[model samples]
Target chain A: MTTTEAPAPSASVIARRLVSLHGLTRLVLFAGFWLVFAGNDPQSWIIGAPAVLLASWTAERLSRRRGRDVTLGGLLRYIPFFLWESILGGTDVAKRVMRPEVDIAPGLIEYKIRLTEPGARVFFLDSISLLPGTLSADYRDGIAYVHALDADEDLLDPLRRLELRVADLFGERLGGEPDA
Target chain B: MNILLDLLSVLLILAGAFFFIAGTVGLLRLPDLFTRLHALTKADNLGLGLIMLGCVRFAPDGLYIAKMLLLWLLIMASGATASHLIAKRALRGDGEDY
Candidate 1:
């Protein structure tokens, strides 16, 4: 089995820097944020514009350091699905709680993640807790230990989909075994 | 029309309150830490969401609605993150004893 190592910084650094420095993308993001903060107040733009620009610059720097640039389109697609799942999750727990007899078959399950990128892996683990009945209890050695409300719940399929979605957001593909 | 909207808002708020009560019940009655986290995060999030939806109808302007929605989003993010951290810590403790 081939082991995949984290990409070493060499020629890709310049390309990553350029991606992070995409000014128009940053400006558009800032505009959306300003709309949320200042609304249609034209006077507020004086303050909002500069603040947004600074915030976006800081965000760009952070993403650059992580070596992972977020795709706006992917994020947009991910939000609705995430929101829906959260609602479902809430309702599921509420139903179980309100039942005459509380029925829960809790157990710890190990999930083997395919995403090798650190950012993607972190996002995947964080999202697990939000996706109905499963909470990521620990992550070590390429596996996440998840606490499940019901051991029999079909948790793996949604997890795989989420992993793929995160990988797409970061423009990364799952390949090879994680290096030990 | 005004009365109809008001009635809907009241109903939504009541529904949201019911979820909060259910979440509290679960937190008190749940057997373990992880299960309690599930109860708290899920029920509280949905409860707040329903409350936000009800209140948004009463907001006089678009900006107020946006602000309320942003507040809900921030709460959801923090709630999820906090739940994960607590669950992780609980699991680590369990591992050491076992």
Candidate 2:
């Protein structure tokens, strides 16, 4: 639901920014990963530095979506929500399965995605499966097709809440609510 | 303090193991592929989360705790992505063997 878009940059300008900004960020992140695994060994850096560089280059080459700015505050807020929901999600499934009679009403539900960023949408899909009783099956034309363990329940409410959380995380404003 | 940490870790690990057992049983009892996946993700998310959290309780150093957390993050990402792919494939009727 983004409007009044900025004019697209020239290809060379885009490439320069991509390399200087995006590439540098990836380089630092990859180096951090290397350090976390390799520790402070000077001997390890002989190979680790080159390996980290290669990884950053490869990541830049393969990434399809432009990097989206994520707010650290938003991330801090989202983590607790994510952790609590996942725990509820886990126990929800576990309780259902542990009952004397195994009961599940499995079916698919299509959810309209409000977030504009492709990366955010992809995150939504990845996260839907981790929530209670919902597994994302596919996405097409701005709608996410999700497989629900209980199709009978009101699934849209939870999906909407999750979408709002994702939007907050990415600092994106969703299009105002459409008719449910 | 050490005894308390050890006791907490033991309880968490036991709870984690119970969830793993529940996930497996659900995977077997569920009627179809999608439901089975729903079951498996619980184990991937909560079961592993609990176990890693338990490990963190007695971690020897900051680096050790960070590594444990990183492992959990990696598994959760991979597990979620793979679950989506599998569900998509099944929906497409690509793998009819199920």
Candidate 3:
């Protein structure tokens, strides 16, 4: 019988791999998350120990195709911008809801993405859904199909800005201005 | 200082409640599923975030505040992912998956 499955990794190899930088980061993160969620009670550690290890292992396995690392400086800059954008988005919807007339000019805009990194692209799409007046409907090739609440409202600038922000976060370089 | 913090907390909570009401109203009155999803995700998250911020003033320790923020983050990520999936399915109009 032909053996199609690859041999299991040696225990030493597995040990070394588990202590690698990416794995270590996940371990620390999961451990910290457990601590925060379960508090410092010694009794909680009984469950938290195995849970943290399992969580870290699962996270590492699931993200095996991990994209480019995000820059801390980029994240620090992006957080405030993201928060402000979300607030604007929320208020915009609230105002429309409260208005005497329900005003919305919904239309789809084909926005070509500049960021090439997978993680960055996913984050940009998620942010678009939360940004003012825009929700990401689909993605094909390098273009994102965005649904705008108001087609008349300017959509390009904010999207372009967001693309640049995400690119920066992933330490990626874009070729030029967003499509005209 | 406590009194001032309490006043600010109350104001934030009130604003948060207003956004929650707006979300419900929009969900009921919006033209379609996509538009209503917008109301559900954005306004409700903002509402909860504001409420969390208000609660920060009353948190007994930094860890309590961290837990609250973490909860908000989880909700926000889930909301974004859920909205995207729903919007994608609606656009596709494939009920076979359902």
Candidate 4:
């Protein structure tokens, strides 16, 4: 009988062919998380290992297909932009609470997203929605349908910063001066 | 050691409860959907995280505690995603953003 050779774990090779250490770092974090949750419960650990592996595998698969790499340091640089937007949103919310007649511009602003990568664009849109007062309605050809509460000058600068940070996260220069 | 852990747990749970209360207040008092989401999402996520962290101390072993941490992380992730989807829908409609 001819012996059949095993596929020799090439699936992982194929999977991790594009995986970076940063991706591995994220995976390790989740695995450690599961292990910790399993704690001294050996019975639970058996189940937990598979679950953690599944999650990590999924992450690797997605990242490989998309080829997106976001550095921790790069992400940190965007925090200030997010914070500024959050503060602005808070102020607008405060105004609305204080004055009922605060001009609430309730409409979709078809802001063309400058970020090229679809993944990054979606992330940017999602992150914008994470904060208060901004919502992404739809995306098409690098454009986001942003809904803002107030059409004020203050939001303009903050929005610029957000766009720049998002562009940076996606590793794009977008052919313009970085947001001030 | 147990007493100290207990005391710390109590404080964390209490703090979490406070944040939850604030989120509820914001949810009720906020004028707009976007604003309400802000209060509810951030405060409630953090509150729930803190509460779980405190509760995890009662877990018997490292495994259960780790599971608790994973649950908290998932909660945060799903919370972010759901809030995002809801806010997007709110905006897509005629609701205001500011």
Candidate 5:
């Protein structure tokens, strides 16, 4: 019973900020990213809390519109696996960069989505770009266009694995048949 | 070993200070803000990194050092992110280069 919805003014911004806040893959590679961001000033949380107070609001709204809101517990479940992948991603980037023959086959790719939230979808796009050898070309209409340096199985494999990890966190399914 | 660590710390702090001063000067003298940010951010990031490295050297053990280094990473993330956000905003406002 879902219908095409009307756009709102703040939706534009919520959409963008959602992308910025949710994508942690890149920073995760950098090591304890948010904890570090919080470590430095100790005062950052002060400004950040209020600035981001609106985020929870927008996230809920996005979920209502799109049908998925990532609960804190669900999002946190993948942290360990995500950390391991970050280490592997760092090595992958180093190997590809150092190797002379490994020419990167970069191009846009469309990844299908199961989550209905536009914000959550954008989050997925940003996190994928954070990995080495892959950049997000774009995400539109529930499809993510991923650009990879090497368009081989490895690239797709990691994303597949990552999607599973995220799905496990959110209790959703990805790239499987619809039993309808 | 203790003496060596102290010397290392001194050298690192001095080197970091040098880089910071150079970056500050570049920020003051560069003709464009982007260029200024270029000099400032890169230098500041590495400068703080070295200073953190030096502090870690003098610390009691690796765990304490890791904690301190974690602090540096935090500063870096915020600094880099803020710089980018500010630069993007400035660029939109008819860009005040330098």
Candidate 6:
């Protein structure tokens, strides 16, 4: 039998390849997560290693189908804003509930989403519920039906701002106005 | 310094408890399921967050603080999701008054 000889790849080249591999990236991420959750205990690594591997493998398969990645820096910026909004939302509802008249003109507002990505669209819908006086009721065909505590309140502006923020988080620029 | 930290933690926890009570009041007093959901999510999230903040101040290690923060985040996500589902159901005529 004749053996074909090939040039050996350099160590740096091998490491670069491994780092770029999606499965390996996910494995490293899951392993880090395991370390954190296991409280950095070395003894727990025996159990954590297999569990993290399996979890990362499954997550890799699922993420491959979806194929979207969020910017962690963007997410970090979004959190404080989201927290403040949540506080405002809670306070607004509390005030309304405590008032004697309970003056609310509840109605459905149809909002047309301009974000093209499905992940961004879903996030937008979920986040709407956390905003003051708005709750997302249904989403279909690129349109989201939101229930407003006061129909007269100008929600579109805030919603648009939120859309832009979400777009920024996804490293995508939003184009065009949200349908009124 | 120790006494000051203790006082701050007590204040934070008390504030959190106040929000929890307010949320409960809103839940019982709100007219519709949708409005009630709004109160519950907002109040409870803030309440728990404040409590977690207090706990963070007392936590001996960074890891414990991180875990507490993680718990708060999980609670916020679950609360939002649960509110959405309930609102959706209410819209579907599960309750007409909402």
Most lDDT-accurate candidate: 3
lDDT string, candidate 5, A8-44, tens digits? 4376665554555443322233334334444555677
What local lDDT score does residue B10 receive in model 2, on the 0 to 100 scale? 91
Error of 5 at A134 (Å): 2.4
Candidate lDDT (C-alpha), each: 0.78, 0.83, 0.84, 0.63, 0.54, 0.76
| CAPRI quality band, candidate 4 | incorrect
Where is model 2 more than 4 Å wrong at Cα? A1-15, A18-21, A176-180, B96-98
Give the chain B TM-score for each candidate: 0.91, 0.89, 0.94, 0.88, 0.81, 0.89
Off by over 4 Å in 1: A1-54, A64-68, A168-171, A176-180, B1-4, B94-98
Off by over 4 Å in 4: A1-23, A40-44, A62-64, A79-95, A98-103, A176-180, B1-77, B87-98
lDDT of 1 by residue, A4-91 (tens): 3544445455345435557557768667767877778899888987887677656544453344666888889888988798788888
> Which prediction has the highest DockQ against the true structure?
2
Q: Report fnat for all candidates as fractions from 0 to 1.
A: 0.68, 0.76, 0.56, 0.20, 0.00, 0.56
Report the C-alpha lDDT of model 6 over B1-98, residue by residue, as the tens digit.
98999898999898788778878988898777777777788888888888888777778887787778777878887887788777777767666565
lDDT of 3 at B49: 93
Ranking by DockQ: 2, 3, 1, 6, 4, 5
Rank by lDDT (best first): 3, 2, 1, 6, 4, 5
Comparing 1 and 5 on lDDT, the stronger one: 1
- DockQ, candidate no. 3: 0.77
Worst 10 residues of 5 chain B by lDDT: B30-39
Model 6 Cα shift for residue A176 (angstroms): 3.8
Compared with the true structure, what per-residue lDDT tens digits does model 2 show for residues A5-79? 455555565456547865777688888888779877889999998899778655555554565767788899999
B82: Cα error in model 1, Å: 0.9
Candidate scoring better on lDDT of 3 and 4: 3
- lDDT for position A43 in model 3: 95
By TM-score, the better pick of 1 and 6 is: 6
Instruction: Look at candidate 1 and give me any clashing residue pairs.
Output: none
lDDT of 2: 0.83
Taking all chains together, the TM-score of candidate 2 against the true structure is 0.90
